[model samples]
Target: MAVRSTHSPSKIPTIYQCDSKGRENQTIAADMHGTLLIDRSLFPYFALIAFDVGGILRLLLLLLTAPLAWFLHHFVSESAGIRVLVFASFAGVKVSEIESAANAVLPKHYSEDLHPETWRVLSSCGRKCVLTESPRIMVEPFLKNYLGVDLVLGTEISSWWGVATGFMARGGVLVGEQKAMALRKAFESSLAPEIGIGDSEADFAFMNLCKEKYIVPSEQRVRPVKQVELPKPVIFHDGRLVQKPSPLIALLIIVWFPIGVLLSVSRVLIGSNSPISLFYYIIQLTGCKILVKGTPPPNAKNSRRTGVAFICSHKTVMDPLFVSAVLGRNTTCISYSVSRLTEFLSPIRNCRLTRERSKDAKIIKDILEEGWDLVMCPEGTTCREPYLLRFSSLFAELTDEIVPVAINIRTSMFHGSTARGRKWLDIFFFFMNPLPVYEITFLDKLSPDQTCSAGKSSFDVANNVQEMIGTVLKFKCTKFTRKDKYRMLAGTDGLVGGKPGAVAADKLS
Candidate 1:
């Protein structure tokens, strides 16, 4: 395939000016940024790697270069700015860390930023390729895993002894002419790509190679692709940032971090010491919102021999605390791996589970006999998204009266959940949000017909409770469990090597 560029740099035709898309078996080469994604700036993705892998100090260092990065991006070449970001975020960092961030953190952002029209064009092709100026390591996982792209030819970064050198390879940044040459090299023996899509003059180098080409305009009025529209659902992601962190947002978070820490500590102290009647008021005074919807059933039913089992959706580690507060009585929570510090600070009793079915069941029965309502997060782990993990059937087999409690947490800036970060600081992160909202909905208690005592299998009972909660919160239910969650986020079994899960019993005794 061969084509000529008849238009000037500024006059390149936009996607709106060309045919929408086709379902034919054609090959495509689309620029990753601007062309595929709505945003063209590369700082936020780099900032993710900096904070995720290198910690606070490294993230601050990257932030310090923001002004210079902006100047270089505007005054100098875009590649110059990208180089500065790559070096600041990647220098001396482990190659594994970079790969982890790209795999876990960047995908959510990239999926959210996919250009609607551009995706329609790029996704329709049979063999899709992405050519970008960013490091190949940063963009490959998302493109191949989520978008089903066939090839990704991006700028190569240098590394030594499993650590990034923070410098580009001998081929230099894959922009302008470099992208064009790389494209040719990638398809030297294979059939030439039939179509190309780009946003700017820099992308024209490769876009001119295809028989058909379309330019994505700099300003896109079309809405970015919604989460449901994505080719793959991003069920598991690891990062504290609840939203994409532009330079301004990053600076705001940095400035508020210290103040947020103080507020969080105070709130924790208040929650642990305050009386039940005044707990909600005192906590609300600190700028967090707690909303309880639906009616909470009585602590226990006389018809049931055992205490009521509260099956709650997991979000932050504070789910039990809030659920207990809304019920006007405390519930003994099951902690899988709680910190010693948390145990000492909690007013509610925490019972640790052994993960073995028989041992855990005995523990649950023993706790019930001790005159305490039991709250179990059958999902085992916390999921930030609106999807509920598979429920544990152990709870269903133990109790006849089950209350399905659906909880939703809204954060302004920081997420309170993490699979890779310090699990002990989860409450602190939850409190760090400027105006966090904790919404709790207490569904009707499960009838005897829905219990194991009534001929229903434990598995069926567990699924019923899960479906009830999922319907209340409008969240989808999945078969994924704690092991699946850890494998995706932290590369572990979510146990035998880590902190307790968000709903795991806490020692906050």
Candidate 2:
């Protein structure tokens, strides 16, 4: 007693014709396969009789009832059509039942086209089948690209003489029960549980067949999906992940070079003569004794009016004081300070370069113009270790007689926050410890062709300075290169708090 039709009947056929209870009384039952079987029953029989109403009145009433039925049927059909069309016009699925139906009928690409998150769900599914309105030929080509899915079911497009006819062999109709039937066939013999997603009530029958269901929410109010977080890659400087000193700050160090030297020298010679040698003796007696191995550079007296630029490694704030005290008043040294050109003209007569004016080439030019030799520490800042900072090319801007000097301090205690072996809070305690030995070496001097050049850029000058210092100190001199002492100072900043070789190896490992 099962029925099949193109569409649901407008109404179940009248149970009986003429006789109220005929074969309609038969009993029907459905088995495991959902097929219905019926037991026929006998109907009660009665003699037929005819009854007549007033002829005209009956005719008038029949006319009225026929038009009313027709009007109502048209109204219902139109309403249903509008509803279906409205759902079809939507860009995406909305209702849970409809979404379930669509997913049951579609593949990963189709679901992803609707929403990206569906990719995750589809990937988790062990196996899948796709049912689309498109023809099998069209869908098969696309499915081959994905390759993971097990099956594709779609309309069959009809072609004649290698040209598409206006018709599809299986018809391109993807409506209502058509979608549901395709989903049922795919699931009928499958071991895996089925899942469905759709957007309308028409998909309910298909969705109901699935074990799991997902419905995309309306775009207007859908909660935003959570995104995965990733870590940013770390950047390295000179082959180490260290905070770089700013170019501006380094430039300031160049501008104020003379100032830093003057302040440090003044502190060393607080109550002594203007002669830097007097200050040197005091530092030696104070136990920060510097061991001078090489003779005072051979050309020390050779450069009469020849401007000598003393380029030293920056190890401590006391470096300039030590170098100047050792060199005495014989040469003029540039250190970080304010106003070099102005100060060079004074009676006390030393050059000053302010941090703000580091880029001014005119200042260096004016200093050399006055016939005084220039002294500078190319590693502009005092570092904890025996590393050399890139030198400023402003030295190249000065006369080319560049002298590379190296200062080594054997300290019982290092000072300042820039000092070695002090915690952030304990930095103030560094000066409490007794000072250490100070060793100074005046290495060879070179002419303009040897060190300074207008052809090279400022960065090149910094590199050249590193090379010059490295040559005299007998250590690797690139920006990446570091001595044992520098590694110790780096520890003061909590970088590595042990011996240079061991700590650096551990860090590299």
Candidate 3:
């Protein structure tokens, strides 16, 4: 077997020469910033955390310090500039808030930026570690969960009384020689890691420490690793920013905030109050694009004596609203522990559910018997990925007239949903985009033979509806429930308000 060497009295070879084959037994240290990630810029990630965790005030604070940070980065030192950014973005923010953004938000953004050729080499190693100038808390979750990294060597953020002080600990930013030292300490000896991967001049010191090294070509014209190519699929991510906020995009958001607020409010009021026949056309004038596919079953009020149960693939708090809007009439919506403000701002009448199975069943049955069509997301919570969470059987048992609805949303600037932040803002952020789109697919309604009353089990009917919606949306159906989502994103059991009865509304199905 032959080994590739950087010190062979010849020009160092690119990562392409580092042969990923048979490297599964090797340990490697890979850089996170410019090396593994396609874009070398750090401002956007800092901005994402700042805006998501601290809101506009924190974001503004970060922006004000940008000039000084840029100066220090170019003239003084990259570490000094990064230090200022750390303080501006995270100082005084609650540790829990930062952690939530890390767990729920950063992974999707990080996964979208993987450097294809670089990832080819990094993913082959048996043991992997990441070295970067960013805070470890910010990258740890994503690196470990998505990329199979065993260790993350990065700057450490200090905390006090459960809040971040924004000051970094002892060794400061993990750049230049500092990064090399951390790698050495983690491996416990020199020459322990068999390979090193990096892209910038700042990474040279650390790359020299490994037994062998490979440089990721900065000017190489290679496409980024696509989502389908990632080591693990990013099925769940939570954040209000639909697009990654670069310097220019961040500025636009700051300027667009007030204008978007007014537009969103006006759109909501008009969409809710407009006549059913004109709801689709009227909402588009306010920057909303709605595309309805497949024929929706006629309104139960006119076509049948009993109301219909419309089950949906949850995308946002606005799912029920659009279902009924697309139908041009109000559909009764039931939510579990939905915020009062969301219900108040919404035009669709909402029914709250008590987890007591019998009580919930009665409420649903009574509503259907009244000949009022009802819409609910069987998955319970909004999922951003192209996968459906387990459908709740409760909705299946309540009615024989079951209809499955598939809903998908597209936003250019911000997501309208969150697991750890303000829940009421889901709808507001949704409408804040310049051209938000809603694609609603109404699948064929189930026949009486498929209903729970016809000897089919409740779970069977629930799953049947789930498969139908997933098929049209090109999504995979899963057995994971809303509890699985909350446990990962919010560190809860899909409950809110600290009460057992406060589980998220998806349980209302």
lDDT of 2 at 198: 40
lDDT of 1 by residue, 90-124 (tens): 99989998887887788888888999988887877
In terms of lDDT, model 2 sits at: 0.39
Residues 1-509, candidate 3: write the lDDT tens digits: 11223353235578888888998989898898878998888988899999998787777788778889999999999999999999999889999889889888899899988998888888898989899999998998899877889989999988999899989988888888898788878876434788888887777777777888888877656678988787667767887887787777888888898899998888888876777568778988887999889888887888898999989999889888888888888889998879888887777789999988899999999999999999988788888888888888998877889878889988888888887778888888888888999999888889889898889999888888888888899888876677768776754434446555222223212
- Runs of candidate 3 with Cα error greater than 4 angstroms are 1-10, 189-191, 272-278, 491-509
TM-score, predicted candidate 2 vs. hidden true structure: 0.36
For residues 85-137, what per-residue lDDT tens digits would candidate 2 score against the true structure?
A: 22222113222312222221122212112223333343344555555443344
Every model's TM-score: 0.92, 0.36, 0.91
Best by lDDT: 3
Better of 1 and 2 by lDDT: 1
How many clashes in each structure? 7, 32, 5
Q: TM-score winner among the candidates?
A: 1
Which lDDT values do the candidates have, in the order given?
0.82, 0.39, 0.83
Question: For model 2, what is the error of residue 450's alpha carbon versus the real structure, in angstroms, after optimal superposition?
Answer: 1.7
**What local lDDT score does residue 346 receive in model 3, on the 0 to 100 scale?**
70
lDDT of 3: 0.83
